[model samples]
Target: MTQGHHLRGIMLASVACMLWGISGVAASSLFAMNPDVSPLWLTQVRMIIAGIILLIMAQGVGAQPLQLWQNKYTATRIVSYALLGMVPVQLCYFEAVKYGNAPVATIIQFLGPFIISLYYLVFKRTKPTRSEAIGMVVAFVGTLLIVTHGHLNSLAISPAVLIWGLLSAVGVATNTLIPRPLLTKFGSLSVTGWGLLVAGVCLNVVKPLWQVHLTLDWAQISMLGIIIIFGTVIPFQMFAHSLGYILPTEASLLDAFEPLAATVFSVLFLSVQLTGFDLFGGALIIFAVMILSLDAQTLAVLLHRRHSRNTD
Candidate 1:
């Protein structure tokens, strides 16, 4: 990529991160209005609305052709991505936030990268490089610190919430890892939009329109719309566009900012109190992500040394 293109890509990616960071605040405001609304229902509505909007926009901009789904293989991949990745990730995450605080849930969900590394190690039999290993350890330790609130002895997290949070992480990892090859064939907007549409369809199966009541006041409806536009649609488009110039791993490292930004927003706007431990733990997690984003050559050297030691 040219320097100008690189700068534009970075700007786009940063915009995505900023919008995603503010999503929690938007969701929080909505929840405050209608505490009774189930997270499942909310996520379903948001995805459907965002998907429709994107579909329209895609057509308008000619970013996606009329026969976007003409290929059978592409259709299959889109369906799979939506059902397994988008749906589960969004549902599990909202559920996690319902059960636990948003900041905590956001931090937990950010564990997707580490989970992706672990998944590759276990299923693909791929050994993690030394830098990856260090990153994993640091991130895990940081998570523990955050979850336990720096008081390991007083760890009293709800089991159900923890399970949901971890499952959300898994869903995110699957979304990121499974679509790599397909992404080469299809543009990001096409993949994301179709996947979102599929996920919306799947969600509707559980809670039909007859069961859902759109009784929200103007404020709530406006918040939901903003969430759909800014939180879901805009960020995805910006992130996808940025991917043309930046590598995926680098983009993911930049995404680590979302959780940190969410934490800050939660504390500032929502008046969520963060103990000293929370600050410390959050710092560690950010540090770990930075280490992981280091150049691959450094990681390769470290991995080589570890392999040599193992042979010895």
Candidate 2:
């Protein structure tokens, strides 16, 4: 890819993360306003609407839309991705924020990148470079600081909330890894479109969306529209498109913006607190992501240049 394209990919990924952060804040607000709305119901509306729109977009761009359900193996994989990755991601993260607050829930789900790194290290049998290792450590420490607020004895949230948050991280990793080959094959729009569609259908089976009634006012309807359009569809499409131009590692690193943005939005709109520890911890995580964005070769070259300058 050209330098400009690469830069554009990074920008796209960053904006996608920011939108996701905003979405979390919006979803949290919805939950607070409509305590009767079930997670499944909310997810169903968002997924089905966005999925339909994306499926149309996929076909408009000359992708094989039918292939998402034609070949049995491909269909199965798509279903698995929907059920295992997308469903868990949306449901768990939303439930996390519903149970706990948005900031803590978002910070906990930031473990997704580390989980991806460790998955490669253990399962793929790839040794992490020094930079990768150090970045992971720094990011992990930052998460701890954010979660525990420097006190080990007291966890800020309940165990169930923590479990849901970690589950969201798993969903994040699966969402990244499973769709990669699919993105290369069926295209991002097709895979995500089908995944959302299939997942929405499956979830509706469990909890019929018709049964969940919400007395939504105009403001609530507007918020739900933002959640569906700006939050679900656009950002997901942009993030998937960025993967075509950028590596998964870089894309994942860029996702550090999500939690930071979520924290800010939550504080501003949701009455969430941003304590000193949260700031310090969030900074460390962002710094760690920056480090991870630099490849081993680049870091090595920079070190070599620094050493030569020092010798002179």
TM-score for each of the candidates: 0.88, 0.86
Tens digits of lDDT, candidate 1, 54-154? 77786777766335579775677677888889976888887876776667777777777667667667875778878779988888887788777667776
How far does residue 1 in candidate 1 sit from its true spot (Å)? Answer: 4.4
Best by lDDT: 2
How far off is model 2, as Cα RMSD? 7.6
Model 2 quality (TM-score): 0.86
Q: Local error of candidate 2 at 162, Å?
A: 1.5
The true-versus-predicted C-alpha distance at residue 35 of model 2, in Å, is 0.9
Question: RMSD, each candidate, Å?
Answer: 5.5, 7.6
Deviating ranges (above 4 Å) for candidate 2: 1-7, 243-250, 296-312
Worst 10 residues of 1 by lDDT: 295-304
lDDT of 2 at 198: 89
